[model samples]
Target: MSKSDFGLFGLGVMGKSLSRNLAQKGFKISLFNRHVDEVEVDVAKNFKAEYQELKNALAFDNVEEFVASLASPRKIMLMVNAGKTIDIVIDNLLPYLSENDIIIDGGNSNYKKTKERFDYLQTKGIQFIGTGVSGGEEGALKGPSIMPSGTKEAYNNVSQFLETIAARDKNNLPCCTYIGPEGSGQFIKMVHNGIEYVEMQLLAEVATILKHKGKNPNEIAETLDSFKDDANSYLLEITADIFRKKEGDSWLVNLILDKAGNKGTGNWATITSAELGVPNTLIASALFSRYISFYKEHRVQFHKEYIKKSVSRLNLADDDLLKAYQFVRIINHYQGFKLIQEASEKFNWNLNLSEIARIWTNGCIIRSSLMEELVSIFKETNTILIHSKISKMIIDCKPSIKRVVSDCVLSDVTTPALSEALQFFNGITTQHSSANIIQAQRDYFGAHKYQRIDDASGKFYHTNWV
Candidate 1:
């Protein structure tokens, strides 16, 4: 038979699913996994047994054989863990790869590391593409949102396949695009994950608020279902399902541990935001909330020590809660986009914000009705907050958000995501804040200069007090 069209390394869940998906799309695929131990070897054997029935699918135990089986100017996608595993795969594949052969890193890798690898591989005439594949296990088997970034020439070799296997929106547009050179794909994916964190936390807070008001899981699920028609989102939809799920005699959600676990992407977003000097307060609060949850014992003891009897529940309207949710969702999306905008300029990525919004409308966890509006709005305006339409919406919704936050506070329930979002909104909208006093105090103590409102904007004045 003819050589396989492309190759996939690392026969893990993602790698296997992608191989099958590609094969079903009529592209032949050669598969291999590193011989790390008996478990890995057994996984590869099982993969070969499962797909050997398909005429277009091939599997090999040897890395060299896998690379050699691919067509000329070989294209191989690696689904291994990020960091050192990526480097190891490249090192092992180099001996078998020739000029113009391509390697794609389809993992949650750091963009900086991707750039370093791209540069390092170029020295040996091997093309490197740092691509991000989103949409969990099921999406991998069917379709996913694909983000690829590398040299334009390298992208051309894989663009067709990437687009073919990517999920499509209602308009049937593929949820895949060439992001830009030097790790732009990974950077965009990082922002996607960051937005996801904030969204999840926001939903959890809403659920907690409902539960505190004597709403059972089913009641909460029904209430969440009402938002499906308006604020329809994958996250929201699944949250409803989670509430309705039963385990033994109790709700599955309640049975699950309170502590949330993360795999570092959320932390990466917070770190990158600080490094970029972007105020991503909502995302930061979401990460901190998870860290706080880990202190289960301490929280339990604190709750026992601070017990108060006969605390009354604050009465809140569902409309107000819904409006508050919408407002905070918009804020979270705005923060992610702002980070993307700043990173694009800082890294010279030349990202298309509108296209990014369009591609995110499907497949990804953050996919939502909001993305559709964002695509149109981004095309017409550079800064979303400054847009008259969006500005008016924020102004109209602020009262509802404030009311919701007030209720949460009075009820002694923590709504960090909502509170931080409100804080962000207040900070940006305020024309004159308490910062004037801060500037004066700074000047009074450390001789830091203070900008005078009466003077030119950049003119600074220092005062001495004895």
Candidate 2:
């Protein structure tokens, strides 16, 4: 038989779906999943048997056989757990692999670790591609936005298959690209999740405010569905579906717990932003919202103790809500891309913001009409705040957000992400900030120096205050 064109090392949900997608695209792929005795016996075998598209796939429980089945200059993708498991899989495959073979990491891994691996693989004469695959299980089976970073030569070797299996944009072009070198793909994906956190939180806040105004699940779903403009997105669509889901006449969304769970990407994004000295208050607020949700017992007790006699009604219109959502979303996207820009400069990645926005225009969870607009915006200017079109939109939408945020506050509604977004906007746009007082206070006690406003030479002055 002819050797397989590609090889995969994990048969989990994502791995299986990707393998099926590969096979469906006519790439003969060898599949392998480690045998875990009774727990995961015949994972690869069963996966191939279950998926008709993978009829000709080579399934192997033995690592050596799986490695040997692939053609020379092998391309193996690891879909295993991130962190230690990635290293473990690479170590196992190293003994069987030849020089110049490529290994792709397809999980949500930390970019720092990916860079380390990329460097380590180079010494062994093997190429490593750290790729970020977005869109959930469904997108994996159909198509997903793919961000791949490695040596240009290595990416060229794998571009045909990667592009073939990626989601297409409105232009019918694949939603995949060469992001940059040394883990920039993973870093971009991290920022994507950060923006995702704020987006989800914004939606939840809107739902809560609407529910407080006596809107039912179906009503809310319809209300959300009516946002046919820039607010339209994959996340918004899924959220509407979630609201409409019913379980024996009861809305499934209500029965579910108030707690939200995250798998570390949000935290990583927020941390990276702070490390890079970028202002990412919206994402931080969103991450904290999830943390706050985890303490259900404490929340309940605190709520009862702090309960007011009567809360005012949110008197904002659905139009107001839509305006607020769009305004906050633009800010969130700007913050996310700004973080990426800082990382690119610091790491010398030379990451292309326009390409990143373009790939995220489809298949990704955050894909939206806004992302479609951002593709050109980033091309014209890397900074969204300075872009004439976006700046004008922000200026026009400012009043609606103010009205919505003020109403939510008076009505005793918590809109952390929205409120933080407004604050971030205000802080960023201010010509003279309150930080001068902070600098003076710091100089008073800590001997810290302050820069003069009139100084064009970028000099600092230290003052002694009694």
Candidate 3:
């Protein structure tokens, strides 16, 4: 038999979809999954048996056989659980891997951990890549956005294979790029997830407001579909479809639990933003919203104890609602990219923001017309807030967001993410903020120093108060 060109470890949903994608792309690949006595026996065998595309695939229950099946300078991707399991898999593969062999971690892993693994593998004469694969199961089977980072040479070795299986933009370019060294790929993925959280919350808020206005799920779906031109996105498309889904006689979404679940990437991104000194308030508020959702009993109890305010229909036009949604989404992207920019500077990654935006134009959860616009915008400016086109768009949408926030407040609707997005934008754009008063208060309480507006000398001074 001919030697396989690639190997993949793990047989989970993502792993299986990606394997099928590679196989469909015409690469001979070796598949391996640990046999759990009666639990997961012959996963690789079953996968190959199930998919016609993987008919020529080599299925191995043994690690030695799996490694031997691959060609020299092997390319093996790990799609298993993140954290300690990754280390265990790497250790298991280390014995069989030769110098210059590449190992790609495609799980949602911490960037710091990816960096440590990269350094550790380098010492062993092996190459390591921390890859961010997005677009979920369907995208994985067809195409997904692929962010790969490592040494340039290591990335070059696998670029063809990765690009071949990645989603294509409208211009037919693959949504895959060689990100900067270390774990920058994973860092970008983490921030992408953080932005996703805020986007989801914004949609939920819109749905809540529309529901209060007597719009049924089907009507709400129609309204969402109307925003398909400029605001077209995978999440938006899927959300519209979700609203249209029915459970026999009732809308399925209404029957489902209100609480949302997360897999840690949002938390990681929020904490990382704080560590990097970037204001990702929209993302933070979204995370907190999820946390708040977990206390169903407490919320119910509070609802009973608190004075009930009448919730009325939101008095807003669809055009204005669209403007508000777009405004907040722009802010969300700004916060996410700002965190990425700060981390890039701090870590000396020399990341190409344009390239990052370009790759995100397709096969990613956050891909939209705005992201496509950002590809060109990032080439001229690092921040979207200052971009001429983005600035005009923000200026035009500002009034709508202000109106929406006010309406939500009057209607007794909660919009933490939207409200924070507006507040964050206002706070940053203000030439003279209330922060001076904060500095003065800090000085009064703890003897911290404050700088005066007239102090061109850039010296800090303490002032005594009664």
Which TM-score value belongs to model 2?
A: 0.98
Candidates' RMSD to native: 1.6, 1.1, 1.1
Question: Residue 416 in candidate 1 has what lDDT?
Answer: 99
lDDT of 2: 0.92
For each candidate in the order shown, give its overall lDDT on alpha carbons: 0.89, 0.92, 0.92
Give the 10-residue window scoring lowest on summed lDDT in candidate 1.
Answer: 36-45
Tens digits of per-residue lDDT for model 3 on 122-220? 999999999999999988998999999999999999998999999998889999999999999999999999989999999999888788878999999
Clashing pairs in 2: none
Off by over 4 Å in 3: 307-309
Clashes of each: 0, 0, 0
Global fold similarity of model 1 (TM-score): 0.96
Question: Which window of 10 residues has the lowest lDDT sum in candidate 3?
Answer: 307-316
Q: Write the per-residue lDDT of candidate 1 for residues 1-466, one digit (tens) a residue.
A: 6798888998778988888889889888888877757455655566767764445577787988888899989999999999898898899999999999999999999999999999999999999999888888888888898889999999999888899989998789999988999999999999899999999999999998888777999999999999878688999999999999998889999988799988778899899999999998888899999999999999989988896654467578877888899999989989999999999999999999999998899888889998888988999875888877778878888899999999888878899999999999889878999999999889888999888878876888988767
